[model samples]
Target: MTDDAGLLEETAEDLFEDAPCGYLTTRLDGTIVRVNRTFETWTGLRRVELLGRRRFQDLLAPGGRIYHETHYAPLLRMQGSVREIALELVRADGSRLAALVNSTLVTDASGRPRVIKTTVFDATDRRGYEQELLRARRREQEIAQHLQRSLLSGDLPATDGLEVAVAYRPAVAGIEVGGDWYDAFWLDDGESVGFVVGDVVGRGLEAAATMGQLRSALRALASTGLQPGPLLDALDGYARRHGVGQMTTLAYAELRLRTRRLRLACAGHPPPVLVAPGARPELLGEGRSLPLDAHAVRSARAEATLTLPAGAGVLLYTDGLIERRGRSLSDGLDRLLAEVASQDDQAPAALAPAVVHALHDPGHADDVCLLAVRIR
Candidate 1:
């Protein structure tokens, strides 16, 4: 034989035996017929131990073996090839190797089934990368949760003749934190209390930060003796000027403890619910306007005023309380009103949580926030 022919044959053998990926040829029944040196080295098995003594699926983990038999084998037979199926292989030392496999069904001259040729690529690094990404996401969620809880913490305004309570629940089905928040405190007058329930525009850390900013800005604006309508207007200005919370929705109210007078305004938020003594619960639909910073040129926001009878109260909430899949806004509003009316005449503290729980939807995917205030 010529030296050139011998060298060509040797190079081909070397390429098959020492390629980066493991290579194997099996019979139609998956009995190993031939395997390259790379496969033997990867599985910690000798050629003699693998040839005719084991099958490709036999080297897989128990779960991988089941998947191979049920999906991989049938698919390869039907389509004549399978590509990039991830699986785990149990090596001779009982260790597992994450691998991606591709297989081709070779046919005879008449196209009858012959042997199966497969290549296996190591996938440990890829698996590690995916796991690290998941861990990072989890860490971000934790930090956001902590920030949200801290920002939402604090005491609500409570006095002998007045009561305030709040309840907040995050989305149950998603990994990202939402931007729902509630706050209640005394205005500078010390006789009237200011309370609000608001929703910022986004999710995660950015949304939580925006919620904090808007809450602080609203409180500062309210303490300056701004009524509900003008308070929201000024807040709109702040949002537009600072570029923080555009299109945010909220219901702001100020209640005088002595006179039992309440003033309220809603900036594209759900209408507040009114619970009056010896009267049916109803939504306060007046004093509504577009969401904060919704328009380039703002219009005058409206405010409503009414006297609350003894034992009367108001409920302010975010959209998550009355928004649901497959339910119209009117239907949700009716349901919330019904739930509120059905609850026994109770203090704001117990009433807030009870009403929230009654309207709770396990499938809801946004934050729910409600604030209840009552006059004795």
Candidate 2:
């Protein structure tokens, strides 16, 4: 060979040996046939012990071995290549190395499968970053939870011959908290009480914060003796001026104990369930309007009124209680009505959780907030 050709050959060999990533050639069945010095250096396993003795899949963690059999091997054969599969390698010391792997199926002259060539990049730094992110997300979720608890902490208005209760549950499947909230407070008139359940749009810390702001605003507005409809109207202006909680939905109601009069208004919220003595549970599907701050031009919101008999009850809740993927809203509503009907005789405290437990789907990715009030 010419001297320059020998120099080029030597350079190529050195490059393969000292490359930044691990390189290996294995038989179609994963028996290691050849490996670079970098692979030996990274795994603390000498080439002599690896070549022809250890299979490539044997070097992986147990879970990765299963993944290799189920996904990696199948895809490599079918597609002739696979890229960026994350896995963990079991090193000689029994420690783990996170790796991003790429592999190609080598074929013979007639396109028959012959061998597999693989490259692995050390993902320790990337793995560490991802772990730190998860930890940070968990910490933020805890903080938002604390904030949510503090914002929701308070007593519902209960007087003689009146009972009030509430239940709140966050989502089960995600790292971020949701924006569902509930409240009940006595109006200026001692005989009347105001209560609400609302869902602010969005998630995480900002959603919780928006829920707090809207909850406080609604309470403040309700204290002015404003009825539910006008109260929501004022709340819409507050949200627009403050640029928060736009498109939020809530059900607000006032119950007068002396007269047993019930008035409710919905701002693009789910209808409240009404339970009266000697009657089947039914939806109060009136007094509905658009969600808060939904339109550029504001109009007067609507309110519905009804006279409740003694021993009647009302349920106000966020949509999370009933909504599920692939399920119609009316179906959810129907299920909720059925659940409420089953708990007809229960008091507000017992009924709140009973209805929630019955309707809350563990796999649903949303927060649920329910408020129940009964007049004795």
Candidate 3:
């Protein structure tokens, strides 16, 4: 060879010997024919121990060896090459190292298989980074749960003649706290009681904060002997006064035990469900009224009526309970009614948890809140 050719060959050999990645050449029968110094160092095996005595599959971890024999080797033989794929290799002391492997089949001049060439990249750093990211995400979810608990305490006030039960579930399992809330309390007159269930428009801290503010305002106003409609008007005024224009849906009701009746109002919210003894669930207070903050000086009114002798339960829920992508609101309500009809007794306290569970889809992308009240 000429001097320049000799120099080029020497440079190539040096590069192959000390390259950052592991490299190997094996005969058709899977015996290692040649291996770079980097491969020898990575596996902690000497060149003599690796070259004719070991096969490439022998360096793989157990699972990797099985995968190579079953899928990778056959694929390489058929396709001539395989690109970067994650795998693990066994070290001399039986420890494993994460790696990305690339392999190709080499053919001789007679068109017969001669050798298999492979390159392996150390992926330990990348794997470590991925694990750290997953840990950080779990920590963030933990913090979010803490914040949710702080925002919405799990305490509901007891009211006379009302058996109230609430169930709140976020669409995401790890995040159960949401902006949906239920409240019940005796009005100042002590002759009447008020209950409200509402949903703030988003999720997380901001939505929960808004929910707390609205709930507090509603309770304060409802306690003043104001009827359901006027109370909601006052709430709308508060929303306007505070420049809180975010959309909210709510159903509020005042019960007069002496009259055996309830005054209900809906503000761009789902109708309250009334389940009577041996009867199908029916939607109450379906009047059209704009949601709070939809317009200044809104003229929303409460629909007042007496409960039937067979009065059993009332259910109020956020859209999450019945809303689904591509499904109409009426259809969702129909599904909820079907579920309610199938149940015996149909008391709010009994059906609330079941409804929440039935509506919760692990793949659902929205939050849900349900409040049920059964009166004897």
lDDT of 3: 0.78
Cα lDDT tens digits for candidate 3, 261-366: 7788888888888878777788885544778888655665655565644357778888888888788989999998888788764656668888888777777667
lDDT of 1 by residue, 42-122 (tens): 889888998999999999999999999999999999999999999999988999988999999999999998999999998
In candidate 2, where is summed lDDT lowest over 10 consecutive residues? Answer: 337-346
TM-score of 3: 0.69
What ranges in model 1 sit over 4 Å off?
1-15, 24-34, 51-96, 102-118
TM-score head-to-head 2 vs 3, winner: 2
Off by over 4 Å in 2: 1-12, 61-79, 90-96, 109-112, 167-175, 188-191, 322-335, 342-344, 357-364
- For candidate 1, the 10 contiguous residues with the lowest summed lDDT are 4-13
Model 2, position 103: C-alpha lDDT score? 98
- Clash number for each model: 0, 0, 0
Residues 117-190, candidate 2: write the lDDT tens digits: 99999999999999999899888889898898898898777777899999888788967878888888888888
Candidate 1 TM-score, true structure as reference: 0.83
